[model samples]
Target chain A: MGAIKKFMYINRTAPYGSIYSLEGLEVALIGAAFDQDVSMAFVDDGVFQLKKGQDTSKSGMKNFSLAYSALGDYDITKLYVEKESLQARGLTVEDLMPLTYEDQDDDYQEKPSIRVVDSEQLADIIAEQDVLLNY
Target chain B: MLHTVNKSPFQKNSFDTSLRLSRKGSDILLIEDAVYAALKDSAIAKTVKQAVTTHSIYVLEPDLMARGLQPARLIKGIQIVGYEGFVELAVKNDKVQSWL
Candidate 1:
């Protein structure tokens, strides 16, 4: 077989504070469209993308929680959230996307099936990728 | 691995680590506040030299412009890249890690 092209997606922003998370999602979507073996990881503020019940309406930003749910349809599974981020915010993985598979549609798996990764695991996983994109 | 340094070379640990790890398989990308290192005579610029001697490094043009500076005269061998180039880095490197 030829070289396996693995792409890692790094998100480093809060959901409502800036365009970083939304843009990250768009870039990941585009990457999956091109058929890359992709993995998503969140660090620092990036963990906000996986938080549950985000109401950006008060801030006048479009809620993108649904977009995250759709990542499975594109086979963009294996999402990881930094454990430190959740701890810093006094939250646990349970407060984030609660399910990994969604029954909403058969075309994709459920949302919130993300794995919680500590910094060391994150570094190890990152070292294994062939391609890495950040948002 | 390609390391993305978006913070000031002094502020975040990424810059220093990226440089130390700048072997044949790794690169350092200056993004966000990290682009501050691209300025002439800045603290970070001075430190970047050590990394350049061993590895490839670059700065994001948009970030530099956002800070109202040009990389034309500041860097000796550092390259400039657009957002698309950032994407290209992801496509080419074995791994991409962001130091935020």
Candidate 2:
């Protein structure tokens, strides 16, 4: 009904420490219904949300990290992760879950959606957004 | 762009990460608990002092006062602004990024 607006959800909190990380993901999933241009940026401790093998069994909390792999179905494929954030936390791209989306424009070929960017590059990406939602 | 950090730098990496990622000449506004980073003698003062060269740094006046901090105690090059200034910063910038 309206022009597609760029919506970027910046996640800066760690998972399980508080509810921000999960809430951010939930809102992003819900926002997908509107079909606007959506992207998520994981910065600071937010990178923890994508870490592989998250076990919450002892904490009794649900392991929602798996839900990220489903984002491709929602058509929310862009997930920019800050490289410095990962290094500061002693993590690498390999430590994250392999999230991919089938590129409809490219004959439905599966393609990686996570882009690990340096701070300078991430700043440029952030400046181009029409709306920024922080969590 | 304008970047706002609301968490304390001493307690969180929000301030450092924001400072590192914000583009050159971008406006960085310290508000809420983040105003503490503007103090001249704080552990982060050196970093704030260095950031001023590349970015315009501002602290919420009310938040600073509420924390018992005086303007004279703030690091040089750091300006103090009120709520109106906060709104103005948001309006002036093409976008606002909050480091929570």
> In candidate 1, how many Å is residue A3 off?
4.1
Q: Per-residue CA lDDT of candidate 2, range B1-100, in tens?
A: 9999987675589999998998889999998667767866544677888999999999987666444456776788998888789899999998999999
Give each prediction's DockQ, rounded to 2 decimals: 0.02, 0.02
Minimum summed lDDT over a 10-residue window in model 2 chain A is located at: A52-61
Candidate 1 at residue B5, lDDT? 80
For candidate 2, what is the lDDT? 0.83
lDDT of 1 by residue, B3-53 (tens): 888655433576777666656537778876676566554434556665676
Docking level for model 2: incorrect
TM-score against native, each model: 0.52, 0.59
lDDT of 2 at B31: 82
Q: Give the clashing pairs for model 1.
A: A100-A113, A101-A110, A102-A110, A129-B94, A130-B94, B7-B34
lDDT digits (tens) for residues A16-105 of candidate 1: 445777888998888787776788998865765676655543234466776887777777778988887666544577657654655355
